[model samples]
Target: MRKNSIKNIRVNEEVHRELSNIIRGEIKDPRINPMTSVVAVEVAPDLKTAKAYISVLGDEQSQKDTLAGLRSAEGFIRVKLAKSINLRNTPEIKFILDQSIEYGVNMSKKIDDVTKDIKED
Candidate 1:
């Protein structure tokens, strides 16, 4: 399938919605940080695997702990997905820490520093 094509977009949207609901309401794990958000979901064409990118609103340690919690609850999440979505096979879910927000913050800080140096000079 072509990247960013119509089909891929549809799959991504569906997976994202399902995952958001699962994380918010279904899974009852206490270890999962309450501030976690399902930033994006990428599903393969064959629908056998899904990469769920999560943006955690916390410091580095909190993010790491949240990821660990999600990883441990993968089986429970998959079971819920299988029952929730009508598919031949429920895709294996993989939790990934999405650092785009952090990257943006760092980039902005760098730009600010550069501007300050230029003004000083």
Candidate 2:
């Protein structure tokens, strides 16, 4: 019931898969960017709450708008997830923006620049 038990891991994966599907196909908010992807999901052992990490591809404005859209549709998303999963109590959906991809890209670029400089030397 704590720290990534088998049951908790299974539940997390289920939530992640179902949420990705719902977000991709069901959400209709214009603010929600088409590039938005559910990268990860962390479901509490009690199943009362879950945090869904989303990666929004695009500029800052687009990412912000997509997050706003997701927050606005949280209730509807929760309902759909509950129905799909057949859970007695649907976990509250909390959307978190995952900026690790961007960070990684930036770091890679920096590394490339450093390597190029080294080669020139």
Candidate 3:
């Protein structure tokens, strides 16, 4: 199996765009934090499953709660996807907590702290 091929990249990009729009504009669950962003989408080669990486722009607890809400609403989301897209089978939707945004924020804070310390010294 070839790795990081053009087809995989295209599919992942398309999935990300569609999922983002659906979650932001279509899904009406209030528990879903409005700050939530669909960061990436990973679809299996067989297209049986899709893991959607989401970044919640808030505290840790808020992120966890939003994920729980999304998980419970998976069936509805899948049905909507089936209706919206032309596919033989709508992939099982899995919501994943993406910590990259948090990580980046933390790293920037650390760097800022170091710079401040150096300036004080």
Candidate 4:
């Protein structure tokens, strides 16, 4: 794997932070649940595109709605992001549903069940 440059990493972090704040505070879309959160962001070295992972603390329907809302507001979000951060070119934002939290919870439960079985034996 190639190592990412310091500048690219920094840009990713700043964008992640700014996006989290904007989604949490500024955007007021009914489809976007209050439990929605920015999980991670991956920016290209050229800063031309960014994939933002968002976690929705709710059912599948909620997650779908949140992603839809973010995708719809992509333009507005990019504009706001560019205004907030001094970048030569604003990266295109793509919203993706992050199910890591749910997967982790499921894994934890499976581990607990296995441990319980081992203890029983």
Candidate 5:
């Protein structure tokens, strides 16, 4: 199957949703911040591997801790995923820390500050 096939897209969405639910409700690791969110999920066409983009709404330490926590819980997460979703092969999840949301917010704040200065001038 092609990379952008309909089936592949559906799988990605299902994996994304299940992952979010598992992380948000199932996991009991204190290292993972309560503000953590799953930004996206990409499952390979073959379903052998997947990448989960995570975002933590906290300091750098919290982000690192969250990533570490997720990595440590990968096996458990995969088991949960397999049980929750009837996939042929449960993909090995690779957690990736995503800072896009934080970056966008920072950029927006900078832009607002510049605009305010312009108005004052």
Candidate 6:
């Protein structure tokens, strides 16, 4: 199948949803921050592997711990995903730290500060 075909898109979305649910509600690892979120999921068209972008709302230590927790629970998460989604192959998941949300927030704050300075002047 083509990379951006409808079927591939659907698979990516389904995997994304299931992964979010599993990470947010299913996993009970203490290392994982309660504020963790699955920002995005990209499943290969071949359905053999997936990259899950994860965002943790915490300090560097918490983010590291969260990533470690997720990595350790990958097999369990894959099992849960397989049970929930009917796919020919359950993709191997790779967790990636995504700071886009945090970056955006910081940028917005900087812009606001600049605007406020202009208003004061």
- The CA lDDT of each predicted structure is 0.87, 0.92, 0.85, 0.90, 0.95, 0.96
**TM-score of every prediction relative to native:** 0.81, 0.93, 0.90, 0.90, 0.98, 0.98
lDDT of 3 by residue, 73-112 (tens): 8998888777776666688989999999989999999999
Number of the top lDDT candidate? 6
Candidate 5, residue 82: how far the Cα is off, in Å: 0.2
Tens digit of per-residue lDDT, candidate 2, span 1-121: 8848998898889999999999899999999999889999998878899899999889999999999999999999998998899776799989999999989999999999999999999
lDDT of 4 by residue, 1-121 (tens): 1228788888889999999988998898999999988999998877789999998999999888889999999998998999999998899998888899989998999999999999999
Error of 1 at 76 (Å): 1.2
Off by over 4 Å in 5: none
Predicted structure 2: clash tally: 0
Best by TM-score: 5
What tens digits encode model 6's per-residue C-alpha lDDT throughout 8-76?
A: 999999999999999999999999999999898889989999999999999999999999999999999
lDDT tens digits by residue: candidate 1, 53-83:
9998889999998899899989989888888
Model 3 residue runs over 4 Å out of place are 1-3
Report the error of model 6 at residue 13, Å.
0.4
Model 3 deviation from native, Cα RMSD in Å: 1.7
Summing lDDT over every window of 10 consecutive residues in candidate 2, give the lowest-scoring window.
80-89
